[model samples]
Target: MPAGQWSSAQGASTSTSDLSGRYGNGRPRGQALIVILAVLAGVSGVAWLIWVTGFHGRPLAQSGLTAYEIVDDHRATATLTVTRRNSGVVANCLLRAYAEDHTTVGELNFTLDGSDPKRVDLTKSVRTEREATSVELVGCTADGQPRPR
Candidate 1:
């Protein structure tokens, strides 16, 4: 009840709000350091959370290739799984086929309706000079840019 002095429910006594007052100064250097570190940690944690969820709060899209099978030298089948984290955003992916030498032999661009758990089984046919050994879903974009990397 007194300025710069109080007692806790456990009958503990203090001359100031700061425990460092026992050391005969306003507050000890270590107390200041601890306060600084605590503030810094709290601020950094908030900033990190903001940075991580910044894109998540916006209209974004992601997609993955769940399964693929080579039907022939010129055709392949794949399962595309697209996730539209934001509403009203349509996404598209570029499916690519590679030859035995890891060269891009064929590619196809496909679109999605941007619905929840969006998935489709698609057949990608590419006329390659050689046999395709593998297929991959390069990437998906909300803007319908089907650039397969």
Candidate 2:
């Protein structure tokens, strides 16, 4: 209760010390909170990356239909370009033939033995029950769904 006085009271002792002395540099709380949040964010990002690339497996190939020739109503041939990497791992691609209305008329399952790095251009014959207009590559994967030993 006095301007210049000494007391053993609890609140009096806290007031006597300077604010910086009491809570070092006025940044202890904020600095600690920032550090904790940064660590958590880093850990969460690494976990998500592992889950995506490890469990889901990385893509090893991509395919495109370069050209198609309509041989007849029941059969056609298409030129396919496949770019594959990760040598020695088998890759598979799914190709589909579609009509003008985007209806799938036929499908082909193509496999690459993965002997070497691939920039392969090959012709494949596709068969449809009815006439089809265009050929397209649907998807490609390297995961062979290996059988458990």
Candidate 3:
């Protein structure tokens, strides 16, 4: 019945010491479990961050469209500059030529031998179904890896 006191369901007065003794070591129940779970979550989050940043951050190979020329109505030339992380692994690249309407008029699948330099500029002649206005390097992959999205 005191202003600063609490009563149990049985109308019995309870004090802070009574609650502390009811729990272990004067700490709330499940506090240790919550702390353990939080520590585990923190550890796993760090591990995931490391895996993402260290392993999957950089691509194996990269390509850039250097120059393109419309040789004729059915022919075009594309120059691609490619770079790879591992020079000992072979890399495959895709080049596409598009018409004025942005439709693919030709496509070329090329391979860079492992013996070649890590960074190389390649000129390829593409035979197209019609006149192509622009060319693009689609992507590149190494060691039979999946093409980059």
Candidate 4:
């Protein structure tokens, strides 16, 4: 019946004793649980960020298509620039040629030996069933390493 005073269902004025009876240590309930959950979420988020940026961010090897030429029917050529984190390790790359209809017409598998530099441009030719309109590097992976996705 008075301002700043809480009442119970039975019309009894609630006091600190009532609060202490409902919540242990005379503190509000759920506060500790909320803080604990917040800390756990923050820790989990930081762990995920570290895993993503430190472990899974960059690829072991990368390849880019520098140039491509449709030599003629049944033949195509591609120039690729390959870069690897470890130049002393061997790497493999796959290049594909596509027709005007977007169908894969040819594919070539090439190797980068340890003697090669960390970054190098390679020119290779592919034998296709028909004429190819364009060529691209499908992927590259270091020896004993997982293939790029």
Q: Estimated TM-score per prediction?
A: 0.55, 0.62, 0.76, 0.76
Model 3 bad stretches (over 4 Å): 1-14, 17-29
Query: Which model, 2 or 3, shows the larger lDDT?
Result: 3
**What lDDT tens digits, residue by residue, belong to model 3 across residues 107-142?**
999888889898898899999999999988887887
What's the lDDT for candidate 4?
0.84
Q: What is the per-residue lDDT of model 4 for residues 20-112, given as tens digits with 9 covering 90 to 100?
A: 777867335688788889999999999999987875566668888888889999999888789887778788889899999999999998888
lDDT of 3 at 122: 88
Tens-place lDDT per residue, model 2, 14-109, is 553587676767557889899999999999999999997875463467667788887889777888777765567676777778887889998888
lDDT against the true structure, each candidate: 0.69, 0.75, 0.84, 0.84
> Which stretches of model 1 miss by more than 4 angstroms?
1-38, 50-59, 113-121, 143-149
Relative to the true structure, candidate 2 reaches a TM of: 0.62
Total clashes, candidate 1?
A: 0
Using lDDT, rank the candidates from best to worst. Answer: 3, 4, 2, 1
Better of 2 and 3 by TM-score: 3
